[model samples]
Target: MVPALDSWQFWAVLSAVFAALTAIFAKVGLENVNSDFATLIRTVVILLVLGAIVAATGQAQALGSISGRTYAFLVLSGLATGASWLCYFRALKLGNAAQVAPVDKLSVVLVAVFGAVFLGERLGPANWLGVALIAVGAVLVAQRM
Candidate 1:
């Protein structure tokens, strides 16, 4: 059996747990702070923690060793992440965390579509059905009664 620590499914589940906690914590944290400022603070904390982890793990690499294409893609991804955080924070500030988080999770659907189109990833019919169900579920969860 694969070790739980080394399993992608295990990490993904942890990520989801942490993400859920982030929404709840962020909602509380945003009570008095500006959403953009809250996001900035969160980003700084993330950078510091990740930097420490990389240093402790000896995973730091020389910037020159990375390819220009990699740098470009990483920059684009950073910008996208910043934009997403800003939008998510704003939504959380204006809406219930329960509602905001489900709508934000629509990113999973987008990722599947974008992966297929841009990364040449393929999904079978069952996978597509699951994606469709996720979209519907997100919409349903985000609805206010």
Candidate 2:
């Protein structure tokens, strides 16, 4: 049986696929451009695509209904995303995508910890173990690959 599209695992796998493509595409694109400019172009594309999505879905009007706190958090998240993209592109420009991508994935472990601490999303032993394994795997993947 096929997994449901709404399942979190399904979405997670989709996200991973796109992320892999992102690394490959960004690496190739960075060869002849400044990382900052590359990031700007990418961000503009994202804005256009997401804007179109929002408009097509009739969610454009929902923006006004969002709370100020939500706006603050989203803006902060956007800034973090921009910073991450800049650093990631710079790293891809300087290092192997194989090495840089895995190291960049260290954010998974950080996310788990932050979620538990800040969001009170408790993780069981299995989840913590998974996070540990990801951290170790990231280190291993970063080694002279």
Indicate which candidate wins on lDDT.
1
Candidates' RMSD to native: 1.3, 1.9
Cα TM-score of candidate 2:
0.94
Runs of candidate 1 with Cα error greater than 4 angstroms are none
In model 1, what are the clashing residue pairs, if there are any? none
TM-score of each: 0.97, 0.94
Best by TM-score: 1
Note the Cα lDDT for every prediction shown: 0.98, 0.94
Candidate 1, position 77, lDDT: 97
lDDT of 2: 0.94
Residues 40-61 of candidate 2 have per-residue lDDT tens digits of 9999999999989988988765
